[model samples]
Target chain A: MVIPVRTRGTTEFQGKYPEEQFQFYFRQHWIRLFMPFARMILITAIIATMGYFLVELSFASGTGSRHIVIIMILLIFAIVQLEFLIHFYNHCLYMVVVTDRRIHRIKKTLFITDDQQSIDLWVIQDIVKSQHGIIQNTLRFGSLRVEAQESLLRLHFIPQVGKKYEELMHLREKARHWYIQHQSAHPSGSAPHPTT
Target chain B: MDLVYVILVALLIIAIEWVLWHLFVSKSKGLIFPLETDESSFRVATPIRLRLFAIAHTAFLLTLICSALLFRW
Candidate 1:
């Protein structure tokens, strides 16, 4: 049986020179979403059950306070729901994207913080990954540290770190090869210098 | 007080819906990544969870509004 080899797929992203091709991308681990989501669910359940009993008790007492209790329950529910939504949106906005030439970290929030960081892949000197604790090891998410010639890029809680690390290493080699080929072909042209 | 509650709930619904629609449905300028680049024609598919959350949030808001209105009546 002939198995096909995996190749870097072509993807396009905005805010890049026309030639830059997307190689891979990933975000923080699923734990980022799961923790907050689990907390929200727990709080919602507590509020729901307690609110149900409280409302029933208040209604039995033939008091007008039941309406107030209902309103309070609804308010708390809204707050919890909003918190979960915002958290999910914030999580979705933060991503690490690798292209043929550069690695980019895009971070944005719904209202506040917007930041993007990039480093050339060809200049990357080392890529190291560490998985601490049993949770990280079992879940297959960890941190990756990329040391470039000038800058150090640290990504925490990267999902599927093992696979991502291998892919990144492979891409780095391809990027370096591409950089060398372009530089040698156009020694005096607009090709990006390896030293710079 | 109940009138105030109704107004607040309505506002919450509107605000949540607006945020969700802007982030997911509308062309969001804040998003660094493009849905699809013009030249390459390659597109990033939105995560299924995100899409599902958007739908679920809208449905939840609709249900909340209906319940609030029914209670008020």
Candidate 2:
């Protein structure tokens, strides 16, 4: 995914409307990157050891094929390096954002594709948090399934799921209360659709 | 000798990194997120650890390139 680098103040995000109040956002847990990172390290170590031995053997034997063998080893090592870059880039680009009016999931890739899904807080029907396995339990990270009437937004490996879930519940209640009050005040053709 | 080839490979890696950075990172630099804060009593601090992790990963790649240079020499 596309790599983003910056930090600033405000709840503001891309595509935020003037009337919308910014809330908080979160990405998949850092723990989710552990497997790919560990795999890269393991492969790099193995390749380095083998490459060292092969380079030394070929060099000491005074063979003309030493340079080609070294180049091949370097090429293989480069592949592992590229793999690490891709994984980290993807991790940085995937995130879920919450606003007073809506909850949004943004997914962007490094090339030409990106996707965003937004669900109005008022339309949220239920939120279920799931933390399976000893690792997720001990690490305090899990998945949240936000069920709307017609759509479901499943946020996986959310860091601090428990705390965020509580905050989300509070925001949803606030949004619903605001919606009800607005509807009562308008009471006619002025009220906007809940899905809008 | 083989050192020239190693250096060429290193240059290739740096070129690839630079091109990728120019294409993706620079173009999307303005995409900023609001600071993590609390409205009432609860505040969620920005994901500083994640940013640090990203920095560390960049450092690791640079190290890999350096290591390749040293290993050949």
Candidate 3:
């Protein structure tokens, strides 16, 4: 039985391996979610206002089906909450997970698309961090573009991307060192594969 | 006639919710994003709160219809 290692990545993702060590698990900045969250709040406020007016109308008229109006409001609120939940789930599910040896770009849209690409750390040739706007510059959030031998992985609007870029560079060097040591230590067989 | 109308609307709501959930929620369960640069299992766990909230929401929808039927206003 492989005892699952305790890490943020493992809890967020399922089916863990004992050997897969985590370097960094990066999620999108909450700023990216602010618009959707604000929209939900605005919707809830509108529903609440409508509900209050409806209840008042019922009280004033005395024949306006009070319980029915209340129920309708609650139903609308519940449905909107469900929509927000779906939106939040989609946001949470999109992540860029960097393990010691692998960089996994995992994205799952709200029931629309799921695209996951894994690039070996050693294969990544270039990593660039770009912040385009004043808000991003002030907030220290930016996009990271990773160029590999075959594929490119981009993480956009992530927080403190400069730090993450540094971390990736450090991890890349470690991977290179490990790869070199493994190559020399093996020279033939005997040693197991450095990493799968 | 009102009761029939409420019941029909209730059923319609349920049918629409069923289709939407199936399309937007259930279909994503089978996907497991690969990690470890190899074929390692990385599954997204469906949040339990979503299921509970869905059940409560469905109950509320039914209650909305029931209230409409009972009040007759």
Candidate with maximal lDDT:
1
lDDT of 1 by residue, A100-180 (tens): 678888777777777788889889999999999999999888999999878999999887788888878887888898788
lDDT of 1: 0.70
lDDT of 2 by residue, A1-196 (tens): 1111222123466666666755566667778778988998899899889888888887877645676676577677778877777776666667677667888888776765577888999899999999999999998889899999999999998877888888888888988987898888886745543331
Misplaced by over 4 Å in model 1 are: A1-10, A60-62, A191-196, B1-12, B23-52, B68-73
Clashes of each: 0, 2, 0
Candidate 2 residue lDDT tens string, B3-73: 67556665766677666545545433423333443331112323464455545655666566556555663
DockQ of 3: 0.10
Q: Which ten residues in a row have the lowest lDDT in candidate 3 chain A?
A: A1-10
TM-score, chain A only, candidate 3, equals 0.75
Every model: Cα RMSD to truth: 5.6, 6.0, 7.3
DockQ of each: 0.18, 0.20, 0.10
lDDT string for model 1 (B1-73, tens) is 4667567666768777676657643333434333332221112334444566677886786577547545632
Better of 2 and 3 by DockQ: 2
lDDT of 3 at A113: 73
Q: What is the TM-score of chain A in candidate 1?
A: 0.85
